[model samples]
Target: MELTAVHEHVWVIRGAVNMGLVRTQGDGLVAVDTGLDKQAGKTLEKAAKEIGLPLRAIVNTHAHADHFGGNAYLLSRTPVTVYAPEGEAAVIRRPMFEPEYLWQGASPLPQLQNKFLLAQASPVHVEYTPGVPFEVDGTTFLPVALPGHAAAQCGILVHDVCFAADAYFDPPVVDKHGVPYMVDYLATCRSADSLRSVQAAWFVPGHGEPARRPDAVIDYLKQRHEQAFQTVLAACRHPRSLDELLADVCRARNLAPANPGAYVLLRTPIAAYVTAAVGQGRMEIIMDGGKLQFLTIEK
Candidate 1:
């Protein structure tokens, strides 16, 4: 809701989910990722107007509802082209796919159909290419792939500031969530490495304050990632079903999925850890009495 200038032309609208704005030639501006819903989109539009920067385009870093939910509202108010990564474009256009995909291709339960999972549909006019610079009126935004938070998720770089969209979480936020959500554990690590390699004057995370020394943040996230993986590994000392594993991990971490919705959401990142463990040959899947289970690999 507050616009803090990161550079002369680059500003970040600090909110629960940070949105970026880059002033371009003339009165035009490029918005990088909207907030959680139509209300958030309206706030962004008003904020831009207060600063005399009219929106010209929208760049969605990924398809997560919280990141792109404001797209529909913004597009409805102005004629702006939307740019999104290829793999995420479909979900942005068909927001329901998010919950459905999370439910394993089955009809999502009512709890899974909330605004956090399903956003209103919006048109995507451009498919972003990672590691390439996307030129707006007179500014260039370098789209850096930062997947694992979501497939094809990316960060936008402009005016010496990098808008890292959920590639990593703020330390306190990570502690608050207990286990940060990730779809691919290895990819998350790679994204952290990618962020570390970027030479920028400042780095802005989707959910935290912008930092001049992003390495410190990245290092903390790396430690958390390793810890979460180890927690899952220890939870799998004996054969356990996915649900059982999830419960044990949550119990050890003092995390309680208070509702069905929370349970489904928390299941995702834990499942990702299981997938990564199996892929790395540290865990094995077995069938026991018609039940699928995961177990630690015997030495």
Candidate 2:
């Protein structure tokens, strides 16, 4: 992992998941987010030690495994307080909640318990209020609410650099994933709108290079979100069960959820689209032969 200085006090460890580091007054640092697993966390710890900065604390922007998976490892190495957003604190505290919720409150299958959905449980010392600035070891951080990618997800703002944790995907990542994962479509759009209004010198996404033009990035995300909504709507013109709709939408988008993990990941976002359409009165849910189905409303 390469640690590049993004601001006077902010440095980002660019890897599979971009982790942010903010130098404090002392020989300490506040890590914004950890990577996918314990090994990823160890990498960050090693890099920090090499730079003569010990991790004083960690601020997780969300509860997603990829964003906070390294929490357990980091804490194991050093005594550090972990801060997470209020709604996400519960999930971070009980990593199993992620897969449990993903499987709709039922016991998740082995495949669903992968690192993509479940991270090692980490204790949260503080449940931060979104949009509130808090101080840690003489450094200040504002947790900007940017929910939609995950429940109660927030972006960390420090030294004019906003570490946007999955608020939106980089254009290429969006293209690669085909269907971006989101729980609430409208909330995601609102979060994009919120990011557009952020006056930041630089913005760091969870999985992309830091952006100088956050507005442009948000614009692209908005367009993709709209397209996703339309795609799901078109797939529902003929009443179809959730499974059938998922298949048709995947086929139309040239997406293949080849594994159980990929299937569940894609299924959740598609379910979000159906919920958004129903909220807008553009679609309705019905029962067909003991199966739940969705049908597009005739305009």
Superposed on all Cα atoms, the candidates' RMSDs to the truth, in angstroms, are 1.0, 1.0
| Candidate 1, pairs of clashing residues | none
C-alpha positional error of residue 38 in candidate 1 after TM-score superposition, expressed in Å: 0.9
Cα-lDDT of candidate 1: 0.89
Please, what is the TM-score per model?
0.98, 0.98
**Could you tell me the lDDT of residue 221 within candidate 2?**
81
* lDDT digits (tens) for residues 162-193 of candidate 1: 98999988899888888888889899989988
lDDT of 2 by residue, 38-81 (tens): 98899889778867888999999999899889999999899999
Runs off by more than 4 Å, candidate 1: none
| C-alpha-based local distance difference test score of model 2 | 0.89
State the weakest 10-residue window (summed lDDT) of model 1.
132-141
Q: What C-alpha lDDT do the candidate models reach, one value each? A: 0.89, 0.89
